[model samples]
Target: MTQQGARWTADQVLALAPDPASRKAGSKLGTAGPWSETGSADEGTVWGLCKGSGSKPYQTVVDLADAAGPAYKCSCPSRKFPCKHALGLLLVWAGGESSLATVPEERAPEWAAQWLAGRRKRTADKAEQRAGQEARSAADPEAARRRAERRAERISAGAAELEQRLSDLLRGGLAAAEQAGYGLWEETAARMVDAQAPGLAARVRELGAIPSSGPGWPARLLEECALLHLLDQGWLRHERL
Candidate 1:
């Protein structure tokens, strides 16, 4: 798995993408060929924008400070993971293209800068607030310890429940999951949400589409199920990770 704050490289980003055809198409559409400017820190997120084929270019953002994993939201219609646009943008940034342009003085278009200033300010404020909270908690260690214990207990319980559900799904047979269709997946997804596993819930929802996915439905379903099982096991064993 990719490590947080690992400093993405051109080859690494390209490797995360699906295929060359998709990458070429995205480049043609001006989705992710090069960067105008790039910014990041050892403990900070990386942010950049790429020219897209649509009316506006796509925004590529990576929060390296958190291990939650990278997120990409492109305007393109492709559904592949780390879509080619995201891969290309990361590749450009990783290639040390930050010096190409000085920071823009005029505010970027509204949509582009909407979260920039606010997020920076919020980060600063949150840091200060957390420091104050830490000082106070240190003075009353017992209370802090209790809170930590309770939070850990809740996370453990939730993970255990998720594991049991996965085992049940496997033993009950995933073949039936297709027959029940979207409703089954949605119901399972709701349960995942309640368990505070929204990512897994989204994964489960995607599984619903495999049945009608035409060729190799069985193989696809099995692959997705194996992935789900892996996620469940990972979460159970390493909740903090």
Candidate 2:
């Protein structure tokens, strides 16, 4: 249905009733005979006081701007969501611009005003919460990107250092590796660990075992060194690959 000063028909108002009893009871009180202080405010809200059997009249209000159709509030003791009083109030408002209860007012009474204020505050709080979650969601990807870049830098530095160490080892001759023993390989692997290159560190540990493998150890050690050197070059030029 249309909103903002637009009025629903009597049939439409009754359609919102919880049951036949509510529809019937609401129709009976739809007239001006038992309603007072009735007024429609901005934002599709209508409120009024209905004379019940009690000393104090029942206060009823309807928020027509609700996305799920009209929302209702009544000071009655009924368990129904849109009680008869609220339905009756809507029916009275459905009478259109000429109805006594449809008179426009700049503000609702204290009771109605309080309910409206509470609803508005809740809605604003929910909106603010969603905005905060969205902001954090937006920041998370950027933080992840920075972390990845930092890791890449560490790996590249490790690879370059490894390449230089391989060059020095080859210049010093393959015979020097056997004399250097496991200590040289262990120290280099530890350096790779500091650089956050676990794969390189593992390969370095494997190289340390080759010197003790027996028979043609020099050829095996040279082959492993060639492979490790190729891996270091690949990492240093990863962007091109």
lDDT of 1 at 59: 65
Regions of candidate 1 where Cα sits further than 4 Å from its true position:
1-6, 10-49, 54-56, 59-61, 71-84, 95-114, 139-142, 158-241
Cα-lDDT of candidate 1: 0.57
Q: How well does each candidate superpose onto the true structure, as a TM-score?
A: 0.44, 0.54
lDDT of 1 by residue, 1-241 (tens): 1234355544334434344564454344333235444444444344555665466656665443332234455555778655666666555556555442323423343443455456556768978998987888899999889867765565556656656766776788876654554455556666666655668766875676576566687788788878877877786677467
| lDDT by residue (tens digit), candidate 2, 93-200 | 777534444334346898988887887788789789978866775889886577678889999998888898889999999877766655577678778878889899
Best by TM-score: 2
Query: Which ten contiguous residues of candidate 2 have the minimum total lDDT?
Result: 97-106
CA lDDT of 43 in candidate 2?
Answer: 70
